[model samples]
Target: MTDTTAFDWRSFLLNWSGEWADSLPGGETRSEGDEDARRARWLGFPPASEERIAAAEERLGRRMPPSYREFLKVSDGWRHAGGFVWLLAGTEDAHWHDNESGLADMFEEHLDEDAGPEERQEADIWRRGLQLDVESDITHVLMDPEDVDENGEWAVYTWASWRAAPPERHADFLAFMRDMYREFHSLRAHRRDGEPEFANDTTRKLDAQVAQARSAALRGDWERAGKELDEAKGYGRPRAAGLGDQIRRLLGQTYMVYFEGLVTDPRYAPELLPPLVAEHAAHSYRDDSTLTFHLRGAGEDLVSLAYATLERVRAGTYRYTAAGPFGTAVERARELARWGGTDEAWRTLIDALPLWEPLGPDHLAPLGWVADPVLGPLLTPERGRELLSTPRGGRTGEAPRPTAGLDPGGLAWLAEPDPGDNPTSYRFVLVEGAAPEELPERLADGNGGGDGDGTVLNERLTLWEARRRLLHGRREFSSYDDRALVAVGRAGSGWSFAFDGDPAAFDRRRFVSPAASASAGSDTRAVVVWSGLRARHGEPFFHLSVARGGAEQYAFTYADEEVRSRGRIPQALDPSRFFGDGEDGAEAERSLLEAVAGEFGVRLPRHAIVNGRLHTFTTRSWTRPPGDGETYAVIHLRGEADRPADDDRTADDDRTADDGQGSR
Candidate 1:
């Protein structure tokens, strides 16, 4: 049943032969110099070079079969004188056997013809070998010292030898290798279309399972169908954990069919229509170059589907796997349905699914174990009721009253109450005297319900208003006459605090260092710098400078390198942790106050850190128990004194501070 001409021993021997013995098909094992052995040696069947075989065996870490070495003597070429013999073992083509002279001629001819191409081919061969070493290489086998029996010695188990075993063993080895190769294959096949079939058994199996699932569904076994489909999805099949996608497509159609039946007969249970409606409403997406798609919709769909699928199984229409998505979906859906969808229920769901946690590399949908994106909105009784109500009148509907627990005035004064009793409105409050036109462009757009054109003006206006109120009642003076003077506010951005001396005209102007220009993306929040001091004339000095550039750029600047270096000002501040989409603007404004306080050695009760891309801060209002004391003090790295007593040797100020009691 086999073709002899198809077997090219010369190429086969050079390529697939892992063992030297396997390279020698048939050869005699007679003792050296024996007449019978010499004759066999001349026929291409000769005993192997004992020394070479033993050394090769030692290096290879495996025993050589005797039959292989025996076949190599006459085949060695230089030893056999005249026409010789060529023998092959089981399954080898017998016609390849020929006169030894002809075999030798063929070998020499190939060597002469292939020299140049062989060199180029060898480079490619080496490259291929290196790749193979990376992919599915057994060199990683480590003999675990702890797993050794009794003694401290370890055993070298051979994955290769096991892999090369007979068909039955190969099947077992395939299973082991499949798991072992998962990571390697993932890298090679990541987002790569057209992967070879042999390397992608997982995907193949999943496709087959999808087919099987559809078949099961057609036979009216909804649970069996859903379970099979879920298994294909659970192992991260069809590129990432693709459960939602399959369920949506399969169950969407299934539920639609059920809906047709329900609408026709009111007794058909309106309960099932919700799941069908939810699935249809959810978003659906397909990844580039992938057969799988996701039902990317609101998490409410997950609850509906999970509940419906579970109820169907409970009602004896479907069967399921205990640990799969269908199983968990069922359990969760039942809980939400039974509890009447409370805040506690949504909280439990959140405890299971945290926001932004990825499901899988290729999966866009978060696993059911995690919470949904619109979790906060979903907690509302109105939304919850819409998601949980059954079609028929099994559960009663008694809506609760609004404003159930607080005085009308108190409720009005408090920022929106924690989401309870169906509260769902958001509002913003502006600081007093805040300019109506200088707000940050984005804020203006967000507040005025317009594009971001005039938001920056609005933001600046607010800052001016707050600063004007804060600076009120402060002392001011004229140059010659003892006339009462005022510091008027104007439009513009940056540090604008007033001081006894003209800070704007101070010599040694601070310029933006080029190095500071390197970072340009961190401009979310403005950094405030303020200085308060007392001069020898007994006049209080105050200065303020606000950085308007991006936080990515360096924050501080001074004319003297020594001054800038010694001050220890932070070069950049990431505002991500301070503010988020939720909550009132109080938190961000409070953070702005703290940054200003830190530069002036003013003690404050709050601290702020940017965490998870939000500009969040700890403030007096944020403290668990409101108090009057400054729990945390903000101090400049360099204290309020312009210069240390020992270091104050300035050309102009040397005589004034000699007594070491400089003005406070």
Candidate 2:
């Protein structure tokens, strides 16, 4: 039971699929056509019973290599395209194929009779057969079981009726298959989509530039912003679905309105400065008496000098009463300009005063509710209240309220299997910028982690650590697809295909579920289903797949390897159980939500339920206080919804109404 470093050949060839062929040029992949037949043919024939393989060996005198023998039981022969391999040969056919008798002498004699020194040399090296199939394809690449490698496995060499150059070698049949499929997919994809250099360093540079441009635009600098975007425009996306292209697209599409007209107005208007600041910008400077507000405003000098002026005012005694110098406290702060501040400086000071109770009336006036037209609309009523009532804004020991959105940690989702499943491998879906080592052998059930080259060998994340990592958007996956997760209990399992028994019986317990009918209103959101593998029938295949639809529907799916649609994954979570879709459901649902809130420090927002699943339109957050008694720095789970929808809006409306605070 020692760990095997070799690529697991028997499992791969057994599970070898032609599904990758669809990734070739024709966009409409595996449609209702010859594609299925082609896939079956390319995958090779079904298993050759043990008796059949034994007959072939008995007739051959010599026993077959263990790898080759094992392969025979999986499939007697590749249906049509096992890289030009044919059926196994008995002794007589082997003798002829190997040229074991007088074939070489005969060829040499024929060359002598037709007599030429060069031709005679060409005939000198007679080819001896290894595991020769009964029939050869147009070209033949033979697995030489007799010739072993450093690990005592066989070597592979190509042979044919005609010779052009020396044959290429592979370490073993499994290694040979790996090379074959690598080329096969490359050729297929090229045939389908035209060759392009994808996922390279050049694309990375463009991504970096696009991200920079996005940052500049967010800070209200259009000129500096457009320059970076313009430089990155030359590189068109490598592939449409890849993360780089998606990132570039998002950068160009979002936040344009914020920068559209701001460049012309260099002056920081009170209406504009307040909205430009980030949520993390506020810092309790020195002590609670003075707070630092960082701004990503119009100009460096304008912003810096404005910041200094505010620091001076903060240094001195400042008061904003109902009756100050002018009609309001904000206008009174404007009076600072007469003493040395610019108009922009005055605006900066006023913009930040909404929450500065030390300088304003004794009321928690969050700026998101500012009366100014420009500031009011952008600062949604829901967000404004969040600034005041959310746990992130609350004092120590006070819980943070949940905001609804996507999982900001990452779009990828993973599931913890039932203890009874005894699952050994875990899968993560829709992750970006991840390498093999980060996920390690954890990603697959078999010995070789994906390609079977067996180089992947690091195990980094503990189950909860993995959950915390993905909840925060870290890259545990290599792709940008954020909609799947799978874990397997046995070796060589994947998505359930042509499986047996009742599918619903295999769902994992204790996972997050969607609500049935939300009290908020008529709610239509996404649902997730976890599919357990029926491991014994074929290859090991366990999957948690998303029933794709809107952004809300596809919040997260727990998956480990490449995903496949194997019919509908059974719904494990009933929204009714958690959302009171029917009567007698709310008390338990609310209790569970409350418990989860207590642990995560977030109140679960409005949500619906389906079956056994819990789906809340709320962001979960946990604050990690600094070690050694430090409290200023804390970590929280941030939400990043895929898109804004009615589910989010409905939830917000319900919260605002229930709390009896109209935007705080």
TM-score of each: 0.21, 0.24
- 1-664: candidate 2 lDDT, tens digit per residue: 2112344645565434534332334444544423654555345455677777777767766566555555556655543233454333332334323544334475576665766754553343344545445555645555554566555556665545565554556666555656555443333333324633333344566667666554443333434545555444433321211212212222322232222223113432232233232111223343422212333334675565435434433332222223232235345433322111222323443344333431111112223223221122123333333333322111122323433431211111112222343222222222112321322232222333122332243222222322343346531221111112221110011111100111212222223222111111233222222233323333223333333221223222222322333343323322222332333322432333233223223211110000001101111101111123221211223347433222222222323212121122
lDDT of 1 by residue, 365-465 (tens): 12222122111122333323222221111212332222111112111222222233211221111111222222232122122212123223211111223
Superposed Cα deviation of residue 299, candidate 1 (Å): 23
Off-target runs (Cα >4 Å) in candidate 2 are 1-11, 20-42, 79-96, 100-126, 131-137, 150-152, 160-163, 192-664
lDDT of 2 at 271: 25
Residue-level error in angstroms, candidate 1, position 259: 28
